[model samples]
Target chain A: MIAAVGLVLGIVAGLIYEPTVPTWLQPYLPIAVVAALDAVFGGMRALLDGIFDDKVFVVSFVANVVVAALVVYLGDQLGVGAQLSTGVVVVLGIRIFSNAAAIRRHLFSA
Target chain B: MSRLALGRLAAAARPRATRGQLVAAVLCAALGFGLAVQVRSNQVAGLSTLSQSDLVRILDDVSQRTARLQAEARDLEDTRAAVTGGASGSRAALQEARARTRTLGILAGTVPATGPGIEFTITDPKNHVHADVLLDALEELRDAGAEAVEISSVGGEQVRVVVSTHLVDAAGGIQVDGTLLHSPYHFLVIGDPRTLAAALDIPGGVLDVLHQEGATGMVAQQDSLTITSLRPAPRPQYARPAPASGR
Candidate 1:
């Protein structure tokens, strides 16, 4: 219940404040969001599987975002930014889907 | 031994929900919040309104517009250079002299002119095409910016028709510089074809007057109308160039 309230508060604050991301950071925001989504799904799956760990979840979330952004930056330097962004999105999307399927199985017992 | 050791290490590092469930929940909440915020901001950024093809089309349109504007600018620059550089003393004097010679040649009807212009043929079946009607046509053509004019009788020699010196003969044929032109006079004019045609065809204009006089007048535009009849330069016996006055 506390976690649900925190999420609601975060959403209300975000809507009311409407903070703008810095221009230099704009390119990385989409990738970071995708990575965060992957982490959230993985955490949810772990929770259903009885292995949920806050430390592991937070660490993985931060690491996922940071690593995704770094890969994109490296791709830009190597003149393959678009290709690498696609690659990253595909991998993270597959992981999210698998975790979501696992969570579904846990909840439905199907 | 290596497989047993690796399995032991993985087992030791694995997380248990019983110990860190609260932290896990908090982190999951944060992740959800961040995702929502990113999605909202991206929506507000307005990049989603344009698809990839739209962006490419916009880029192409901008490039084409730039190219057209650059070409116009180049043309304007060339005109500016021509005006400024062509006005320097010796070049200016030469250009002035050439212009004066051309004008004098046109007025004197001694030079052939070929340009977009109009031609008109007046058939005076009853010899009712009077000198005044012909004069009116000349005045109208002059007002309409006709650079050169020639008139010839049906199947006769073409003559440079000068307005100031031509007269209508008693027999109703036009006489220009001792040459008698009969009915069915064909006029060749060099000027802006549209303007010249409009001037002659205006309501109650020269064409109307000619039609009233029982003369059939027909005007047509030509891409290139040539007037080749040359007139002898008038020998001025008295007027001579004055000596240059000293400052």
Candidate 2:
């Protein structure tokens, strides 16, 4: 219960968080949020299925945050935050699909 | 019957552990709390360092603001061009004022600009008197050594800064191509910040009037400031005539 409550609080903090960014680089928030959610749901389902080890969960979480932030960083470098965010979202979407399918098959016998 | 009993005994011997579940739950909760603290600290830090960007961004925003100001100055040249080319009338004057007003909206935010400059930000009009008194304040910043100024609505709404000299719509919106601006004006000046401060303090200046009128405005000086670049927007063009119209 405490863990759930802490998770809730962390999520709220994330929602309210807005890092100082240039005016031209404002569209990455949505992509980051969606990618984060994809990771959480996919990880949670994998954990329930007993197939997602602690190593995989930790690795995925780090990659999600780092990759999302890296895209923004690269976009800022390339003078194209919007474009980088779009690319990041595309990659995350693909991962989500593939991961969800694997988890589904693992969790449920067809 | 002997085999089934033996399997049941084996299952009982290796029942799942509650200790592991409890440990995982506690660890997860600790991680969550730690993340929350980090996020809150970051938020506070982010606010304090407003417009904070990486080095590349810092340079980009400065250049962008400079380009935007240069673009407006070009608009002024266009006005001069039109006038010198013998374009004159109430229509031209109205068009020029409209263009300046739109530029004013965009200029409301202080772009990180360097090279001896002052910045003044005027909060929104709380009353009719305050609203009526803003033009004088704008003049003060200009006389104080401000080369360019922008007056924008709160948060630089679309109505606050349009890119063109086009007439403001009835909604007090400046249209820049398709962008609009609305208020909470920021006036940026690109000259000696201290000299500009003195200019505003000159006897019988608008600052004195505003002090008497009880309006709110703030002026600040910076050794180094950078304004972020506005993302490039699509250029507007005249619509092509249909075949029927051409005929």
Candidate 3:
């Protein structure tokens, strides 16, 4: 319950502040968001399974975003940025879909 | 065995969510908040412009200005060449002035011009074609060194297209300079045929956009393309050339 309140507070703070992202980090923003989404869905699925681990969730969330951004940065250096970004998005998208599906089944039993 | 039953069995055997569950839920919410903010910012940054037509008009204005600058540069180059040609006599001067006049006249669309170039026929069945699309094609042609361009409906009278021409929406199609152009808009451009054709065929170019929007754009290169249409000389009411100091 405290966590839920913290979550709501974080969302409110984010909306209120509406901070600007730096221009240098602009290219990685979308990829990081997708990675974060994948992590969120995974956490939700774990929670439904009654095996939620805070350490694991935090680690996965940070790692996912960092690795996704790193891959894109490397791709930019190699002159294949667009192709690599597509690859990352596709992988994260599939993960998010599966996790969301599992969460749905756990919640609705359908 | 049903998958749901097996999932239930596995879920029931696992320990109940601990205090860590709260942390994970909070993180998830934070992630959601971040995603929302990111999406909103992206939208605001990308589309602060008013509407599609406004964007197109801005692009058209920029391209027309670029074309005008390029024409001016070409004129300067011709004049420089004439000055450096070492023709000192009055006859040479007269010839140079006449040549410059012809070149400027052609560029200003006040004189007819014919040469090798490419022609385009765009057939829009849905009449949803935008004037900016045609203007983009003209810009591409100009960038590829097109000297003259004339556009008309396939069966209608052609008009000389100038940098200052405005394309307005009509009942059935578009109206360029008071002439209602129907579908299958024909464009005759005089330039390097290879360069002009390549410009249209470039990947993700004008042709690709037209194709994506359900418009059929076709280009054909010709050894000789004639542009017979002419624009009348502008009679400036308030602006005149500055008088020469010695005169």
- C-alpha RMSD of candidate 1: 17.6
Report each candidate's C-alpha RMSD, comma-separated, in the order given: 17.6, 35.6, 36.1
DockQ for candidate 2: 0.05
TM agreement with the true structure for every prediction: 0.42, 0.29, 0.43
**Quick one: best DockQ, which candidate?**
3
- Per-residue lDDT, model 1, residue B74, is 100
**Native-contact recovery for every candidate?**
0.26, 0.11, 0.34
Q: Alpha-carbon interface RMSD of model 1?
A: 9.4
Whole-model lDDT for model 1 versus the true structure?
Answer: 0.78
Query: What's the TM-score, to 2 decimals, of chain B in model 2?
Result: 0.36
Chain B alone: TM-score in each candidate? 0.59, 0.36, 0.61
Q: For residues B38-101, could you state the per-residue lDDT of candidate 3 as single tens digits?
A: 7667777873322334456688999999999999999999998887775566678899999999
Candidates 1 and 3, the one with greater TM-score: 3
lDDT, residue B87, model 3: 58
Candidate 2 has a TM-score of: 0.29
Tell me what TM-score chain A of model 3 achieves: 0.88
For A16-89, candidate 3 gives per-residue lDDT tens digits of 77877666676787899899889877877776776766788888988998999999889878867777888999
Off by over 4 Å in 2: A1-5, A12-31, A106-110, B1-247
lDDT of 1 by residue, B1-247 (tens): 2443334335534544444545655655665566666777778867543334455778899999999999999999999998888778668799999999988888788777778898899998899877788788888999999988998886897888664557566665877667888888888999999999999999999988887888889999999978898888878899997888983
